[model samples]
Target: MTEPTQDSFPVTPTNKIRVAKRANYDRDTLFAILDEGLIAQVGFVLDDKPIVLPMAYGRIDDQIYIHGAKAARMLKKLKEGLPVCLNVTLVDGLVLGRAAFHHTMNFRSANIHGTARLVEDEKEKYDALVAITDHLAPGRWDETRETTKKEINATTVIAVTIEQAASKIRGGMPIDDEEDYDLDFWAGVVPISTSFGPAIDDARLKAGIPVADSIRKLTSRR
Candidate 1:
């Protein structure tokens, strides 16, 4: 693929997509996929072996933030500036074809390449935490109790600047062989979606404490 313009991340060997037709280099496309995703698969090398872990992440501009316990192995290794690759995917549907070989899925996914660095600035760390919390449920940070110094101290946050990224998207019906088109078999897409269920209050909550507005708003949207 050719190098993309300024509006998109430049195409590089590390971030190139083999299926050029499905590749998208636009910043909007990449960020859209990232923003809608609830989990990210982070890949890195540890002890000369490859490791991939699912993590909760938040995006701020061109960077992604991931946090965990201070002593977590992945956080410790990534904070040392090791190369990392993060991926988020949302399955939109299941594509069923007449032939078994043509069965596939409709999905949107973003893959990012960068190096993670420990967040040292106090304000930045706090903001990153808020972004993460809101990513899970909008406006959740403001609706909850403030984080204590000890809680903040025990958590470790790392920022990964998006150096290179690409998004791949597939939608619509399945493609089958010309001969299979006339076969007596079903072929179509089964749409898939994610929705939020009614909120359940904590068992230990005090009497008369209703659901927070953030939680109500989030569930209502779905």
Candidate 2:
């Protein structure tokens, strides 16, 4: 039990990382992993069964927001203030090793434990939607059409204030036995990455309309 630094979240028993070497509790490290990820897997118990669903999310400081249809089962259950776990992972590469048992993937992942509650404030809900839209593509919310009141009424948004979080990162080459090095089996890392392709236009899109600057900039960087 090492104590967490002031900048890191406290390492409670539920959030403690088993492999201390791979554990990262620094605020920057945890936030970076979460921000870079596109999808979060939310886990919770429902009807005595564990359910995990992939969702798009937004982060506002320590709070993470997730939304769905108002009648969706996952959202319905989470809004009851039940405990939940959220996980986001970005795979960097495939770590190939001489021995099958040593093969692994290079990745960065963040896990959060918290209780979710329904967002009742109108302004906060609107801001959270903007954050979620922009998280998909920076500045996307502003470039798109305004959200109608009816649409907002049909959506259910829940906010989870991160109570405990930890990140685990694995990188570089795989670790193989000393004797396996001379076995002549090829071993190396196969790099992997996610990139955006050329933007496609909608079939019904007006001919005079052009791609938005946000999309142009995002695709250019990728």
Candidate 3:
């Protein structure tokens, strides 16, 4: 077997953790959490007010790509080289404790801070589109029809370099007071996961066309 490639993220003021111990600067850990998540919450300032909106994204190495309609307000603002805080999180489970105040969640999350740049080169734009597609549905990009120039021109893609990023994870059972451990309340972890269900055929699918093998593998894993 080949050895896994490793990369490390740099610590910066924006990504430094107060708790210290829960912070991770390892690239592998950050990438793993990012790959498992589909949506990213991008925070940026608009007219001196901070805003955060969830959007779909794809990652290639240390760069993350996000796209939207050409006229999207957020994308337009991001293209101006504004500071961005992109965050992705995966909720693994809910930790129930005897005391409501001790209840918490088991999660893996990454916070990436950088400036957003517009992707303009044709080749890179096409590759970014493919990455986004493959990230959402692995292997489906090749099975789909080719992208038209008009379609590509109408969409705007922004690339955010991972200049400063960090990962934080919390797992296992909840921490409760020693006296609360003997309480009559039930306490444990309730696991949570996103799973693919049975594939649904498109209404317009040709009768002779069968389910794609890539989709079969995707659903099977779930």
Candidate 4:
């Protein structure tokens, strides 16, 4: 597939970054970051207080989905079609510099601004749940039991279109002053890695049931 250029999205004031060179508006970049992110911090206001809630999220095309109990305050407030800000960040490394002032971190972050609407249709909600599950576990959706009517009715899902989004990325070694470089200090980057641990069977698991191949593959890919 052809990659969309960074100029595809408009450079609005809310989505613009002070360091323009570090900002990316490419559709591909935004989608990549969103798909890789397991959690998102959703920002919104309720009762005159601004709050940020970390939630599990899924991305399909240009849409992001987050689900929770129907009675959840955050989900109820968000379904009212209020403006929201969603943020996802992936820390790549710890950038250490010779000087304290020059210390920094290497990371990639994406911020999205838009309004979320409730997803009520049965098929769409089911698909959204599948997407969410697959985001957490690549192929576990099909292995689990199907969603029942009672369960479906108890849950609420919100869909947010990628109307305005931007990604900021930083990498490479630390930047230090020339004079500081000559001082007796160390400077380098400590890379960060992510991995899934081995699966532990449930205490009540049925006898002789082996770990699913999908789970093994998922953990192995890390």
The clash count for each model shown is: 0, 0, 0, 0
lDDT comparison, 2 vs 3, better candidate: 2
The better candidate by TM-score, 1 or 3, is 1
At residue 113, give the lDDT of candidate 3: 92
| Model 4 lDDT tens row, 2-80 | 2335456677878888997788888788788888889999998788899999999988887789999988977878865
lDDT of 3 by residue, 114-174 (tens): 8898999999899899988888778888998989999999999999998788899989998
Task: Provide TM-scores for the models.
Answer: 0.96, 0.96, 0.93, 0.93
lDDT for model 1 comes to: 0.91
- The C-alpha lDDT values of all candidates are 0.91, 0.91, 0.88, 0.86
Off by over 4 Å in 2: 1-6
On residues 98-160, what C-alpha lDDT tens digit does candidate 2 reach at each position? 999999999999999999989989999999999889988889999888899999999999998
Off by over 4 Å in 4: 1-7
Model 2 local distance difference test score: 0.91
lDDT of 3: 0.88
Per residue, candidate 1 scores C-alpha lDDT tens digits across 91-161 of 99999999999999999999999988889999999999999999998889998888999999999999999
